[model samples]
Target: MALAVRQACIRAVIDGYQQAAISGLCPEGAFEAAVDAVRMLDMAAVLQREETAACAAGTENIRREPGSVR
Candidate 1:
């Protein structure tokens, strides 16, 4: 994902948490929940990048090896 998109997502999450708190609807674990949400998002982005890199590498290997197609 692009940096701007990722930043927008993070900002949205933070804004949601702030709105909830301001509306007096915040739960006991609201802070933790927000933190976890952000962490999960970051982890997901990391995993996606890794997966893409791995896939590209795999494709490159197949292209380099003769008779590799099935």
Candidate 2:
């Protein structure tokens, strides 16, 4: 991810923490939830990248098939 995107993600996490703090949730719980959200986001990005790479790899196999038209 670009630096700008990473910074925005960090900003969002901090904002969530602040919102939780204002809503009377305990700091520890809020922190844990915020961290979990970040983890989920990271996982999603990783999955997307892996899917893209797999698709690219599969194309190579397709083009190599004897009857392939590409």
Candidate 3:
């Protein structure tokens, strides 16, 4: 189930990139970079990395008030 969802998401992203490229909106390097990112989209690994980074930054439960900027 998860694999199917992930693959679907990747396909959607790729389709969007291709459409942008066709419209001359996506640069060569940008499209390649996006593809590279999609290739590395591992849900578990990405979540773990993000959790670790958030912990290191001490932003685990940090939040901004309404109308506040980062």
- Name the candidate that leads on lDDT: 2
Question: For each candidate, how many residue pairs have backbone atoms clashing (under 3 Å)?
Answer: 0, 0, 0
Which scores greater on TM-score, model 1 or model 2?
2
Model 1 lDDT per residue over 1-70, tens place: 4664567568756865776677676575566556655655655656577678778978776644566555
lDDT of each: 0.65, 0.70, 0.66
On a 0 to 100 scale, what is the lDDT of residue 38 in model 2? 65
Assess candidate 1 and give its TM-score to the true structure: 0.37
For residues 1-70, write the lDDT of model 2, one tens digit per residue.
Answer: 3554576568668877887778888989789767765665664665567668778988777646577567
**All candidates in order of lDDT, best leading:** 2, 3, 1
Highest TM-score: give the candidate number: 2
State which candidate, 1 or 3, has the greater lDDT. 3
List model 3 lDDT by residue over 1-70, tens digit each. 4555466558756875776677676587557756765765666665576667668778746788989888
